[model samples]
Target: MTAPDRFSFNQATAKYWPIPELVAGCVEAGVGQLGLWREETNAYGLDKTAELVRDAGLAVTSLCRGGFFNTPDWYDENRRAIDEAAVLGAPVLVLVSGGLPEGSRDLDAARAHVGEAIGALVPHARAAGVRLAIEPLHPMFCSDRCVVASLGQALDLAAPYPADVVGVVVDTYHLWWDDQVWAQIARAGREDRIACFQVADWITPLPEGVLLGRGLPGEGCVELRRFRDAVEAAGYTGPIEVEVFHAGLWARPGTEILARTLAGYLAHVD
Candidate 1:
């Protein structure tokens, strides 16, 4: 089968690759799209990175984050994120709903707050013409990283808003273990709530914090192609972002990482 038309290499997969090299490497590897993070884009100066990607004739598929509603400055922060996404020509701004607030154990409240938080940002996001994509991190990250833990939950949070402004992210690495994901993908398709589709393999013997233990496609147990098929079946015709986050993978040279990423996608996902 041919590779997906919207294949994108998320920069987080090659965490330490310098911005210029990452851009050059993607171009050399025939990658036409990218998923960028706030930190990396900031480090490179958002405008400069925007210019670089534009000059390379690459599309900024999605920006990695604009959530964490539990924080004090979430509203302003997310507005800035939306504006930045607009400037970078990214259509979606992925939101990682943060975990419980400090010393708080109210999971229900945390989730509710996320919905309200996204609701508040909808106006700005719509004004900027940038969609806010809520990403459901693995439930393993429930306590510290993200509270929204399933595709269904993410879709629920997005249900109240206009489909163009709020949506959910379907990352295979995080939702692969959930049996209900197929149904949720169907629901997402029916509702037009799928904003981004990310891919990564699930590997075992996780690291100390368990934040960066991911594998390239075909290196682990998860069925990458199945997830790809499900997303497309869900009526998602947008970019397919490869977002593996392995420390070992990150240590490699940027070009090697890009080449391997392309090969992995071809072998396991295409």
Candidate 2:
């Protein structure tokens, strides 16, 4: 089956694919969009990478991150992230709210700080024409990665800002286990807070850290299509990005990964 028009290959899915080759692979495979990561872009020369994708006629669906409120340089770093998103012509900048501060177990304070941090960046994000998309990772990551674990909490953090400026990311891999997810998705649509939609399956016996343990579409247990339908039903008509992070998948050639991603997307997510 052919990939749907909205299918976008997130760079993290092929973690080691060189930027130029990844762009070329997407072009050859008929994929029109991509989700880029900051580290790769910065290493490749942000301007050069932007030029490469643009010249190749590819659109950047979103940029993988700008938030980590617990850091000392968060404000400045996020401002730069906004600038990078603008340069890449990416409308959304996904924000992974960093875990609690050192020696701090105050979940309330951490999440609260995230809200305030986003508030401070709104002006810059808006000026740069980038939407800050708050991403809620799984609960297992709460103390070390993202404190925001549920879509409801993400929406709450986004509620104080204009939907067009600050929104939330709906990543199936991080959210598939929540029973209230369906309702939260609808609420996100009604509030116009669904800025980005990502798809990935959940695998058992996750490797240590669970950061690189994600499975590709149709590889594990997530109801990929159910999520697609939920997001679409909530009025999200943007690109459907397949963003899996597995060591095994990343070891393959970029072209092969893209082919498999497309196949799985068509079979399970599209």
Candidate 3:
């Protein structure tokens, strides 16, 4: 069997799985790459998690988010996140530029704040050898989840920093709706700003909080292969991290979830 080199199973796909068990499962199943969330990583113990993954001979593709700039403690939190990524040997620290701060509808101010916040973290990120990857959430999440709602927006915010220190995440679920996403991906490539690439299918009838609505690749309407082609064409040669989030999927066993995620990736992405 020809294994997928860049097929990384994001830990969130099996949201409730114990980190140690997940690591063991990945090793057993021949999955060499993974993406992780801070909360889970922290719960598993930062150094412990790093040691576990290292011992398993797995590669930590990217840490799932270091940014929430709108928060009061963003400075310290982000620096801590950078250190965490470095500790885990993860090269990328995903950034979810937080949405409009409490009761502040001024989108312009909020976006500007995000840029400045990232600028402040650039030095730390560079020093730690971690790239801050800005992820553009869907527009529906712009008001409360992320202000960077499009690839173009993400690219714009990352423009002021060195491409090595700041870059963008290419997620199909979020960028599929944008007609100009192709152009933006190309621009990101031209500028060497593609830090990471994530895969998730877009599904409808989102949950109440609208957080757990993603589907496995080929389970939704997204053009998964097309997005993959765009990212590859745009010069992104890193791991294609599969990061689907959904309540139903979370209810299953981690092993089963990993199997299904791999099947979907082979059918729809690779």
Q: Which predicted model would earn the best lDDT? A: 2
| Candidate 2: tens digits of C-alpha lDDT, residues 90-145 | 99999999999999989999999999999999999999999999999999999988
10 residues in a row with least lDDT, candidate 1:
1-10
What is the alpha-carbon lDDT for the whole of candidate 2?
0.94
User: Model 3, 1-270: lDDT tens per residue?
Assistant: 234999998999999999999999998889999999899999889999999999999999999787889899999999999999999999999999888999899999999999999999999999999999999999989988899999999999999999999999999888899999999999999999999999999887666656888999998899999989998898888999999889899999999999999999999999
What's the CA error at residue 102 for candidate 1, in Å? Answer: 1.0
Ranking by lDDT: 2, 3, 1
Clash pairs, candidate 3, are: none
Per-residue error for 126 in candidate 1, Å, reads 0.5
Clashing pairs in 1: none
After TM-score superposition, what is the CA distance of residue 189 in candidate 1 from its true location, in Å?
0.4
Give one digit per residue, the lDDT tens place, for model 1 in 1-270.
233458899999999999999999888777889999999999889999999999999999999889999899999999999999999999999999998999999999999999999999988898899999999999999988899999989998999999989999999999999999999999999999999999999888777667888899998899888888888888988888999888888889988888888889989988
Estimate the TM-score for candidate 3: 0.98
Count the clashes in each prediction: 0, 0, 0
Which ranges of candidate 2 are over 4 A from the true structure? none
Ranked candidates, highest TM-score first: 2, 3, 1
The prediction achieving the highest TM-score against the true structure is: 2
